[model samples]
Target: MRSIAALFSMLMPGVGQMYNNQFVKGVVFLIIEHYDNVFGSINKAIHLDFNGAHAEALKAVDYQHLLFYPGFYAFCVWDAWFHARAGADKTKTAIIFLVGGFLGEFAAIFSTHLPIPSLTCGLVMVIPMLAGMFIFRKQ
Candidate 1:
């Protein structure tokens, strides 16, 4: 259940909260996610990136909005997982997401200089999250 919640959140920010029966919270998250997506031009960037127009993708991004995305995304995932677990210790779970968020933001910030500027941020963010799931599987 916890993993399912987290995975849902990863796929779509608010869905996991809905899975946890937090409808209002999920709606709020969905709104926020849409706001970020539009302001950050995330969909456009992703489409451009995947099509091999990395430069255009990077240019399409609004750094101000993009910078907030990793933290927001990470928090949604963590929140869904935490609530799903219902009283599990938060420290261990938090550390993984915090690190993932940090790395994601870092990658986003420095993406222009990275090998694959457009994809670096998402890859950095998801890698730590996936690792966390595996590492804390028993929890």
Candidate 2:
């Protein structure tokens, strides 16, 4: 159940909350997700990034809005996982999300130096997140 919830969130931010019976929170997250995507040009950037148009991808992104995305994404995943876990120890979860968020932001900041700057942020961010999930599952 917990893994399912996390997976739902991984697909879309609010879906897992909805699965957790948090309709209002889920709706809010959905709104935030849309807002962030549009303002950040995240979809456009990712498309360009994957197409190897690194310059265009960088130009497409609105850094101010994009910068907030990693933390928000991490939080949504953590929220669903926390609820699904039904009061699992929060310390590890918090640490995992926090680190993921920070690393995501850090990667975004330094992505300009990488060959695939736009995609780098997402890749770096997801690494810790997936690792955290596996770590939690083992406990």
lDDT of the structure predicted as candidate 1? 0.89
Q: Residue 4 error for model 2, in Å?
A: 1.3
lDDT for 29 (candidate 2): 97
- Residues forming the 10-long window of minimal summed lDDT in candidate 1: 111-120
Please, what are the lDDT tens digits per residue for candidate 1 over residues 1-139? Answer: 9999999999999999999999999999999999999999988988888898888888999999999999999999888888887677788978998988999889888878876665778878888888987787677
* Model 1 regions more than 4 Å off: none
- TM-score of every candidate relative to the true structure: 0.95, 0.94
Each prediction's number of clashing residue pairs = 0, 0
In candidate 1, position 24 carries an lDDT of 100
Residue pairs whose backbone atoms clash in candidate 1: none
Model 2 pairs in collision: none
